[model samples]
Target: MKLWEIAHSRTGDKGNISNLSLIVYNMEDFKEVKEKITAEAVKKHFKDIVKGEVIRYELPQLGAFNFVMYDALGGGVTRSLSLDKHGKSLSSFLLNMEI
Candidate 1:
């Protein structure tokens, strides 16, 4: 299962520190999302590309979730680089995932 399949859609930035906001279809699905689509998961999935801690946050008010993946590119804002060697289209890539 891919992150995007279960998540509604993602919105955020790339290159430096990335903030990825995801919308789950239903609240009940939060567990699955948390358990399966995790920081380690992201690291493992895109091992060569992603790095750092994948922190998750829950927004009950909006019935949404957000993942803040730190140092994902490589080092920090200025030095970190992406697998594409350019940056990622996170929303589209996540949307294409199977989960």
Candidate 2:
């Protein structure tokens, strides 16, 4: 199942980094999400786009995970050539991943 079925996303961008927050609708699904989705998994999933590093921060109290991806915006939005690869769009792409 795709993560989107059980959760939604919020995003933030700074420099060439993309901060994606995956928040589960129900806390019951948090355990599965935490186990299946790792920093390595996320980095691999967005390997082509994220060039630096992917760091995952657990927010279990909120049933969320915040992923900090570096060099992900093609050298920041102002420097990116690709029209479609913005930080905002990455979250949508992430939702496409099957867990």
Candidate 3:
């Protein structure tokens, strides 16, 4: 199943770094997500766009995980000519990940 079936996401960006938070609807879903969603997987999923590291933070109390991707914006919003410079669309892309 897709991750979106049990979770939602929020995205933010600063410079070339993008932050994406995946929040599960139920605490019961956290363990599965935590086990399957690794920083390496995320980095691989976005390898074409991201040039640096992917760091993941586990928030068990909140039933969420935050991923910080470096060098991911093509540049900053001001310098990037890409339509989605802030990388907001990445959240939706990530939600499509299989569990």
Candidate 4:
């Protein structure tokens, strides 16, 4: 199933780092999200876009996972040649990931 079935996400960027937070709608699904969505999995998911490391922070209290992706924005927003490279939209793309 797609990750979005159980969660939603928020995204932001600074320099070449991209931030994405995956938040589950129900706390009950938190365990599965934690198990399936690892930093390695996410890094592979966006291999074409993210050129550096993917770091995941588990927020059990919030039932969310915050990911820090380096070298992800083509050297930041202002420097990226692609118009659709905004971090905000990439969060949606990540929702398409299947667990």
Q: How close is candidate 4 to the true structure, as a TM-score?
A: 0.96
Best by lDDT: 3
User: 1-99 in candidate 4: lDDT tens per residue?
Assistant: 999899999899888899999999999999998888999999999999999999999999999999999999998978898786667888988999998
The best-first sequence of candidates by TM-score reads: 3, 4, 2, 1
Q: Which portions of model 1 miss their true places by more than 4 Å?
A: 74-88
Estimated TM-score for each candidate: 0.64, 0.95, 0.97, 0.96
Give a tens-digit lDDT track for model 3, residues 1-99. Answer: 999999999999999999999999999999999989999999999989999999999999999999999999988899889999888999999999999
TM-score computed on alpha carbons, candidate 3: 0.97
Checking candidate 2 for backbone clashes, the offending pairs are: none
Where does the lowest 10-residue lDDT sum fall in candidate 1?
Answer: 80-89
In terms of lDDT, the poorest run of 10 residues in model 2 is: 81-90
Alpha-carbon local distance difference test for all models: 0.63, 0.90, 0.95, 0.92
lDDT (tens digit, per residue) of candidate 2 on 2-93: 98999999778998889999999999999999999999999999989989989999999999999999889998878988785567888888
Q: Per-residue lDDT for 86 in model 3?
A: 86
Candidate 2 global TM-score: 0.95
| Candidate 1: residue pairs that collide | 1-99, 2-98, 2-99, 5-99, 6-99
Encode model 1's per-residue lDDT on 1-99: one tens digit a residue: 665656675545566566777777777777777666666665566565456777778776676767777665565446744454324466566556555
Quality of model 4 by C-alpha lDDT: 0.92
List candidate 2 stretches off by more than 4 Å.
none
lDDT of 2 at 40: 96
* RMSD per model, one decimal: 3.5, 1.1, 0.6, 0.9
lDDT of candidate 3 at residue 52, scale 0 to 100 = 96
